[model samples]
Target: MTSGIHHFTGITADVQANVDFYAGFLGFRLVKQTGGYADAEQLHLIYGDGLGSPGSLLTFLVWEAAGRGRTGIGQVSELGLAVAPGSMGDWLTRALTVGIPHEGPSREFGEPVLRLKDPDGLIVKLVGAEMATPAPLNGAPTRLRGVTLLTDRASETAGFVSRFGYTNSGNTGMTQRMISDTDILDIREVSGFVPSVAGAGVPDHVAFRARDVDAVRSMRLSLEGHGPTEVHDRKYFLSLYVRDPVGILMEYATDGPGMTVDEAPGELGRTLFLPPHEADRAEDLRAMLPQFALPGEERFPVRELPFVHRFNRPKEPDGTTLVLLHGTGGNEADLMPIARRIAPRSSLLGVRGRATEEGTNRWFCRLDATTFDRADIRSEAEAFAAFVEGAVTGYGLSADRLVFLGYSNGANFLAAFIQLHPGLVRRATLLRGMQALENPPAADLSDTDVLVISGRNDPYARDGTELADALRARGARVDFRALLTGHELTGTDVTEASEWITRTLSLN
Candidate 1:
């Protein structure tokens, strides 16, 4: 029977940073990039050895713009990677050069270990050990050494783990060591510890190896009274999940139908693959998911701009650019999918807001639920103007062909900008917008064209007409529409927005 860890999965908010650390810095090969098995909307990435070996695999569930999580009891708080013995100096030097947060060269459990924190603050311990196929001193980890589980009910968990072929080796302090055929398991018991909160940086589950379908079935049968999950066919493997006595998630996965089953070994991770069921929505999903450039590819450097921004250039460009500004609590990539559908051939530049309200992102400060901060609005608009000017020059984008698209709070900001700075924007679209200024000086907006869309059922729907009136009074061409909907966006918005853009841009 197969033993040891098949893989470990974790949650990460920043996919680019995660890939940079694991694949670029640590030298792991990106084995697969696919949509999540359970949710096709989010992405799932796998990193492993050169051959995409199961024992060396580490997978991640991408939750963009998610809040940070707490690592506490009932979680795998630390992931152990086996490295060649006496490689601490090399590892430390690499970490310093790459700006990876690290601690230790400290000895733990009679082995030299170097602790490095990933961008999301997940603990990765590189333990110096002599492996069967010894990894180079400055190379990718040979395989997973083990994982450190934080459990309050350690004795029960230990007994549960033994069914997967692990045997109690020894104990040091409150930590009991369990040895498997290919790796180690360290259960550190701490009473009265806080339970873990699920979000970014938390290890979701630890999967153990099963020889085949029969082995997985046998294991599932053994877990009858332990609340075992129904078997899930994950394309690459058949797996089942269960929560141990301490509430830590564990899985049993078949080793065959491996990583190379779908894609060739040489072409693995080169293309984004969706689950068979979601293949029909592949185009939409591609636009929604965050775009990333692997290491050594020609990529845009995220510069020190006035606003946090992200750029997505299509494979083929039609010489137009869309400047996207998201609503409150949203990030730079929030409106990517909508914008993509509106103008598939246009380049997208999504910018994050500088102001924050109640720990959530916003274009400008809010005095109250309905009141606006005038001074903050003016200041941010000026800064936003500067950011746009810089982006036009730096990104080699045409200033004359730029189109601004904003939603809600972002829409308000754009409306304010059009009033505060005349003729700055050539074309714009506002969704659920309002008149940002109480009273504004009339500016020459004859060179601009604006579209104002509002939901009739929305509380703020009346304000949309006010914004359209303000733009019209300033000599801008304004098209106003009220859809029969609520504050939340609907398919009607996409249809209207896309048709309007196609007509305005004359894109056949």
Candidate 2:
């Protein structure tokens, strides 16, 4: 009911590392370290400018356990921050001066926001706002103005947000309204809900505006991140956010002189935020964060998983249940970005391989090229079957509603699964993974809709065109494409796959 960006959350294995990553590298100030509402031994970390504005705060649950919590169905998608609109190009120049991997200074639906994922996969959005109030807290040069959450029940969340005077805006029935005395809070609820598995990308919490330390403390009385809340004086703005009902982390932010006090607005994101404690040694902090801007936006919004943010989260959308598997060394969290982008209309259940390959994630055992032990395949296939059966039964989906999406090593096992269980998957999306299975599976893909995307320059493909021809000869209703890419995935490449998937179904 209160205004501001607050109540953002997520789970993590290491709290300090997470904190360092945010406060130090990302330029967020450490405003508080509170007791965990769900777990006491577990700590809650709040990082943001001290202004105490909505969307300026962020909350976290640093679990004592080694296992990571899955970001899925019952979670917020991302924390959208309103930044200098049209200044995305300007932000890009500054973000590059510092070292950060940016995905876009691009558009989401329509809003121009920068998209960056935190160390643990939580998305943080930064967009341009027309009427940002003068910040109150002064901890970081930058401050929080507002926050947006992508949810399965946008209407329900908006119902809660509207309690504070927010209204619905956007062409897609999104909720928008002026939250503060003037700041606008935009919330959109669409059919864009994608169900993710335990390890998939998802939001755990979010925080809102914390006008002052007392208000932050008052908020701490009712919020989890406030238990051991730390007070900061960043000489810019002070802020914080704690955990919420759904466990997604949040933050409270504020803005007065803003990040531009030192540099111009054109240079806002070009530099990093240094906390008061680290301010004297700001140069040292600046040297620590990654030095490459991975080519996208300048100051953008932090989205949940791209898939969760881009597509609708559905228990069952269009009667199909899309199962996604990740590659080795990576968990289920990594692939959902591509999964959500490639198929915004399908319901997704992205999976992480059960077996850990020493340090990396893999579908099955692989000693080297062309060498896979049957023991690994058999066990993984069995696990795959069990996983498939459980998902289908749990979600009440039939074979016709089941789809397969696997990357490199993921496809290795999936191809094996298709060989082992002939009619399980109704459609298959195999990207950069078809090679490991040189020969066709024993089963026929006639009834199944298959989209095999290969990169022309990939060494793994041997020859991409030949691979496409081979699949067509196998009697599969296949739509094969060879893009001018390597094994690496790109947004342009993803768009091609998305178009193919749409056409695949439309033809049917």
Candidate 3:
């Protein structure tokens, strides 16, 4: 049986900030970026030493927009990483240089420790001691040293961990120190403490290393009736999960076919890897995942603009830029997958709606179920126009090569923008959209090409046709197509939009 910790899994609400701190600031090499085991929508990031050894891994599940979690009983309250002995001062200096607030070179467990919190507020203790793993890269911490598990039943938890070769080494106050070959287990007894909440920044589970598949199975058999044990094939490793007596989640994972199983060591974290089951929805998954830039990389900086947006530069550019607008309750990243499918080589710009209704996002305020607030529409349109102008200037994009794609509420806003500010957008695609303006001014759009795709059974189909009519009256060449669907988009939408974009680009 393999001893010591395999890895610790935690939660992070902001993927970009988390990556910046762990991979950029802390200098931990990002070994893998993949979807979470339970849910493919949330990202799972693995950071470790160069080779991504079993005992050196720290993983996080990206839970965007989740609230902060409470750290108390039945939770891993702190993560400890090992640095070379006598390196506490240098680590503290680095933290200060990076503008990260940290506390103390205080002595803990007879070792110097510098304490800090991750972006999501997870406590991290950088201990002064060399770990039994690979050498540190970029002066990053060597490896995982220990984890502090707060629980009311510390003795029971200690007994449980002892099954996996953790022997009680010593104690300090209310904490019992258990030692395995490569990791330490600090079980701190918090009597009558509240159990931890499941949210961002809280440790989800702690995994122990298993020698192989047979070892994992043997461990599962040893704990045949312990709470619940379910084995899962995690592609890189076979694992079994169970709950300890104190309700803390625990796992035994195989260490072979490790982090480099799918990706080369040099290209480990550059690409996002999905499970075999989700291979079919690869493009959609890639688009849905949050876009982030590595630190020191020349990328679009998130600025304080009129509209919140995300930009994705393709690995290979075709000199075309597509600006995307999402529907009601949708965000900037919502339409990225569709945009990528339509124009794979084009740069994608996804802009979020500014207005909100009952907590959900909208391009403009609606007066009622079927009526929109015209004043709000006009104000937002002007702001959106300003954003487009600024984005073109800031991103150094060619105005004539910008193609607009909008859906539903976003499409309605785009329709208003075209009418109110003609000659700005050269090409546009409206998906399940309608006219937002009750009475529109006449403007010449002779230089424009538009595609209006509405669902045949959509409630807004009649209004969408009127929008197409409005565009055509303005002298804009329009390709109107109705698909057999409802309000939601379909694969046929991608097909029609792609074909229309190709035709327009050819003409350009």
Candidate 4:
């Protein structure tokens, strides 16, 4: 049977940044700096209380160039670590000294938690708890207090956890707390939030401790009906993974063949360690990895929404800049031609969506064909807005002359952003778009000029009209046109949109 949490695995944008925050700031020991078992090019790092103990371990798979993740339902929202009682003040002091932003030494479920975000935006909570012994390092966490899984399917997840020997400890508000002898799992029930996207700063998987390979195989058998399972030899430990009903990645791992298998106890984490399979290519892999260095006490400026983008300089440098956003499954260059056709003289900046769904890029997550993730929409909007601000400064473009060109999912994101930010975008051309939020933030769009084009037979056509009306009610100058078509972009739609862009730019 599975016991407590073995370790929580996450994805990070930078390995050195992760080490600086987890080991340098939090005082956790850097137990292992290794390459991923499956991918040799990716760096895998382990941080723990001491000697990389099972319950104390927190691992990260680092990719330096990956975008930020979307945190919502079907994901582990927060990771909790056990700390000695009365250590919250020390942790807060360390956080301030290290230039880490944190919130709350607040009480939750009878425990004090000092919450902070890691470099990649993963939630880390140091909870005050009665520990058996003091940690080796000052302010280092004792052990894993388990993870909080955010899901709409709370009952299903609770039932699934029960099969792994966890018992329901009842609810605190809308959260369901489950517990075993060594682990505490919190299931937060969320509704109308977007499904999670796997990216940098997201918890990749939560692992439960198993006795051995036999126990792992047996657990896999029990998880047959619940979800699909795949067993893999991780060299250090045997692992079995499954996606729960709500889509959170769960794993069962053995705690044998520990960190000392390759490096000696005294020399642990002093040098880069590679698995046997990857050892042959160590030289090549090392050359490809970014330089690892502990950041100084000064805070690093982390880009909120780093995107793959292309910036095109206009033939005549007009003060007006056209920002192009693509729909689902489209890349940064996907909307370039349309943007060029509509505003040839305007500077063109095309951005790719950060979130992915089954390898397809999407601006935000969706619950169903008709339902969108409201929380993710807001998060992506804020990030996108930040990205635009950065672009404006980088390109020496005026914010007042900015115009947004978005289609379908991209258009929906613009609608959400304009509602949240009000006058950030002076003008926008939304193609086949609809409202993303049921109760959008009330803002004054009186100075905004918007052109909304909708397909008559599109499923969200009504939503498109409603959004236009909503904007108009907020005093925006909205020109809405409905064409006799479906969800796809039409030639007539483009022609009309081009005309609208020309007229809007002229008036401005």
Candidate 5:
């Protein structure tokens, strides 16, 4: 039967540095050096035990020039490697000798754990376990012990994973530990930390073992009752990906057609390998990809703040532009259609929220459903304001004609950003958004035009009025409406928003 983690895949900035850390320092074998199956331009490298075992494999999709990612909510915060009991001393000595920055020889759930950060700031924990495989490197880590999933909704995530056969083992402080027959999982509820961003040094997805193709198919059917599930043929395995209640990306993958299927055992990772599907376009893909070579002991400079965004120029270019921001869990492309429907001729700039909860994107971290982290809100707002400034200048668009259109969390972030940089946006449409700042910023926004649309029956209905009053108090012209619907945007909401945009633009 499918057992524990088949592999944990993450993004890396420099493939050479990654090789140096995992293969050179830690002494894990490079099982397969290949190109990305889906995106052939990126490098896909795998590190594992002597044979590239399922539970031992750590995989990375390297984008050499990519910027450093922010670690936040809605992401796998830590990857735990299981080491033989009493081997913590040896591992600690190795880390110190190599100058690896680390913390904690602390004990959690009665297990000894040493935590450290990789070159790109991804957390790696060496966990002491009796059940781990015999280490190949000085009796240190043998296989992946488990993964730590950080989320806001811990109870919901715990319940969901339990439904899929994980049993609650125990809890250490705020972390809930779960055990499957073949693997261990930990869930930590984090509030107030910055939400995670996707880029280099972020664990993108975690895959569980499935017995075979039929087991993977069955798991997909079971997961549908909870949320969305997508099945893909990975060539080496058949897999299904799903997001839990709080947004952690979980994959159930079949165990057959192992890593050695394509290459010979002895020469597994010696040369570049491609999936069968991409074999035809290998030459073309190689031309586009950046050339790589083994590391020579020097570290590369880390680029900061990887922001995911999309800018679209209108076919019939209007002087005005719409900056679209989507709700929590929505991507940059999510609000493009809405922008087009409202302002067809206007250029569009859609920004993906950087903070993630589990796998869902959020503008900032929340203390709970109602309370927000004001500090994080302020930090992200500053970053977003800079991003907007760059976009306006780069796209050759007038800052005066740019209108901000945001929904829910996106709208809340806009509320915070506008308060700090009031003149940056002259007009904005906030849909079902609330005041994100704990203590509102004092700004003279006399000439600014704002429209806030909310559902009367929504839980955050009061936030709409609070935000409108706050804006009005600061001398801005605020138009507030509370429709007869719930939290969702209805046809009436869109119609009203379109009218408001027209009236506001015409006046300007």
Candidate 6:
């Protein structure tokens, strides 16, 4: 069940036009054409390379005139295509040359991508998937990897992906990873559409790759679980559908090798690699096929970090940033999931704590493991504060409009850091706060959206009147809430926090 996305299907406006764009313009193929399998209410069209293997495959519902849907903070924003490595630069140039305006050549989740707007204004991305291999999963050498998009309801979408045999890799992004051979999928969470975008573009709808009926049933089994597997027999292929937490539609595609399996791996994009079952219509498809752009140069660049921070560039005109810090034992990867929470425009940069406590990320000394060492805390607080100042200034991220979020030890450090140096965080959320550092770190918290979320009864980062008074007195606009749980963050915890941040970030 830990397989990457077999495929995800979506409803679209134009059937032939959709096929033209994804196939002719983007170099995918029509793997299938038929009545909707799970829902006879519509038609389904499949496209991708090499039978839409692992990182390929896209399907649409051909809902040509469906009114625009509202995509919000917890919505799936875009779907990414893994293009030739080191080809973004070339593709950007080519796209511009061909009048296909592109926005990136920037880094996202530590990789390169070219962000563009499709005919429908849906966000489309072409990424330089630089990994050598994908994670293990149950499948046929993986025809589809994972569906990529943004979701306000992360766990919801994750649950949906789980149905298609996708397992979490613990890495997140606006476009995150599920597993197969290498990263099979890339899903992102887009807060909203880009300004001036005209139509529904990239993720007209997500589609997964599948092996055949057995694979389809396997995926259905994964999705249905203890109950009966949801199955539908369409004219073209058997399928199943479901709505994940965030409300995005997902589909389990079938085998028959589709278009990708039609041609040799090296010839996937050279010609129309249709499924063998459709050989009789090859000439007809070719005549109707649109010309396509070959894989191009990689435009984005990724550099290693010498210090504690990681910089993941966004593939958009507007910019948003997530300054990540790890708790004990949590390094750069700790706050990566949090970074994924900031979709569409935001990028992630993670910072590791300076000192180690019991081999964990500790900013200062510990007082018998649960208390604080006042002086050590103060020194570490100042140290992190200075780091933030330098980072904001040095990294061109001036404290304005910036979000600083942390957890456990990392949360303690961030709380201390912000208090000591007000204005470093425009809006901040502390997963589990610490009250031991009652020093009132700074005196300039005006203009900051202070969030202190806690488990109902947690010891560390425990909330009491002291925390509320301290943050409020420091001029922080605080939303301190204690949830039903203790110390640990449930998906519910993250869900609430995401909700709060969404509201806080949208204030006039």
User: TM-score of every model?
Assistant: 0.87, 0.43, 0.86, 0.59, 0.57, 0.41
- Give a tens-digit lDDT track for model 6, residues 395-485: 6764555777777777777777777666667788877766656555457778778778777677655564466677888788888887878
- Per-residue error for 282 in candidate 6, Å, reads 35
Model 2 backbone overlap count: 113
Superposed Cα deviation of residue 200, candidate 2 (Å):
17
- Candidate 1, residues 407-479, lDDT tens digits: the string is 9989999999988988779789999988889878779998888989998888765557888988999899899
Clashes of each: 0, 113, 0, 0, 6, 66
Q: How well is each residue in 59-128 modelled by candidate 4, as lDDT tens digits?
A: 9988665889899899888999888878789888988887777999999889999999999989898988
Q: What TM value does model 5 have?
A: 0.57
lDDT of 2 by residue, 1-508 (tens): 3465444556665444465556655556555453433332334555555433334555566542245445454455555655556666765665576655577877654658777666666666666655443453322224444455544565556555453345654444454433555444555443455543333234554445445566655655654532344444434445554433332334454443344465553333344344444445443223222121212323222222212111124324575556777777765445654666566556656666766556776777776766776667776777677667665665566565567777767766775676566666667777776544445455665666667777778776545445445445555667767778888877866786677666665655
| Model 3 error, position 100 (Å) | 1.3
Candidate 6 minimal-lDDT segment of 10 residues: 133-142
Candidate achieving the largest lDDT = 3
Q: Give the TM-score of candidate 4.
A: 0.59
Models sorted by TM-score, best on top: 1, 3, 4, 5, 2, 6
* Ranking, lDDT, top scorer first: 3, 1, 4, 5, 6, 2
**Candidate 3 lDDT (Cα, whole model)?**
0.87
Q: Which whole-number lDDT from 0 to 100 does residue 191 have in model 3?
A: 98
Off by over 4 Å in 5: 134-140, 290-508
TM-score of 6: 0.41
